[model samples]
Target: MNFTEQALKKPRALLLLGICFLAVVVVLGFFLKNSLISAEDTDVLGDFVVRRSDNATSFFTFVSSIFDPLGTIILSMLAAGIFWLVTRNWRYPGFIFGSVVASAAFTYALKFAFHRSRPPLLDHLVDETDFSFPSGHVTGTSALLFSLAVVLTLRASSRSVRILTWLAAALLVAAVAASRLYLGVHWFTDTAAGALVGTGTVAIMSAILFSQTKQIPAS
Candidate 1:
């Protein structure tokens, strides 16, 4: 079988892929935490992004707020609920809820473990007191939107629809990541690592939780 067919048919392949992604997250986390990748080096892009913003600060601030901890939880539940209602199946909803919770838990645990500080208070556009090695906003947003994109892709009627679903999900996640940098609340590595954590969580969770399930046919 070809690559796509093998990927679809083999849970072992998915599991291996998921493990690979998560291994990268761990290695990246270790490097950042140990100062092997200096914060000053990683913060350069963040500084530039924050400094370049003029009138767009308000817009990015608003975007960041939408994916805060509480916001992420609410959106995850709403998406899970909608998936259940539409599919009349528990697996999709379960996948959504489980992936998000796993992502949030992983992100926060890394933050606590790393104990890295945020940008200077003077640079921050929003008040934030927590450790900032891995941005919680970007992590949670990526997990939720990326999981939804996968589910939607499975149910998409055409190739174009699947492409659009993935594009939209990616844009949303990137916007949230950029918002964290633009708000001066996180370093570039923080957001990048957050994306890795979030995506890794979803990948592993999907392999374990949904790989055995039959694909939802397109409408």
Candidate 2:
């Protein structure tokens, strides 16, 4: 669509965009909790998680690797590439691309803003050098799965397919989040914020695209 056509759809998209924006702000606020408060929250949660750590176990270590940002991006790109070839439409890939990029940018920005350190109470399964207010793994993986779920729902012809897609997405996100915590690489709150931000990015981007589509008349 042209600029004029896109501009016309903004009204319909505004509400969802606003809601998504608010959700992000709320998540950021959580990260901005007083240093002492945030530290305590992380400490109690981190200690509890570390006490149950299975870092020596290869299972969760493997799971964590599966959802690393690179893995998630590769999978997302492959899925989007297939969709593009089959339907010869850019919308699917475009939306996925935008969602992942936005999630990643925000994740990094927030990490710098909060500068919360990773849990020091336990050994890491893998070495990481980034600030850890929000788990980039969780954010990227959640964006990949959840945004794909949204695309699946849009494409599905049956309610059952849509339901199953969303269920699978939820399970994947949950597993990745748990793996991050279990790996001693992230605090519970970091994963929580990452989930919110990732999901919210998809919500906002998809709503904007939906708005533009709604303005198009049936052929």
- Number of the top lDDT candidate: 1
lDDT of 1 by residue, 3-31 (tens): 22234456676677767866776787788
* Backbone clash numbers for all candidates listed: 0, 0
Per-residue lDDT tens digits for candidate 2, residues 25-123, read 556656465554365656655664656635544666787888887787787788889878776767778778777887888888877777777876455
lDDT of 2 at 114: 71
**Candidate RMSDs in order:** 2.8, 5.3
Worst 10 residues of 2 by lDDT: 1-10
lDDT score at residue 181, model 2, on the 0-100 scale: 73
Q: What is the TM-score of each candidate against the true structure?
A: 0.88, 0.80
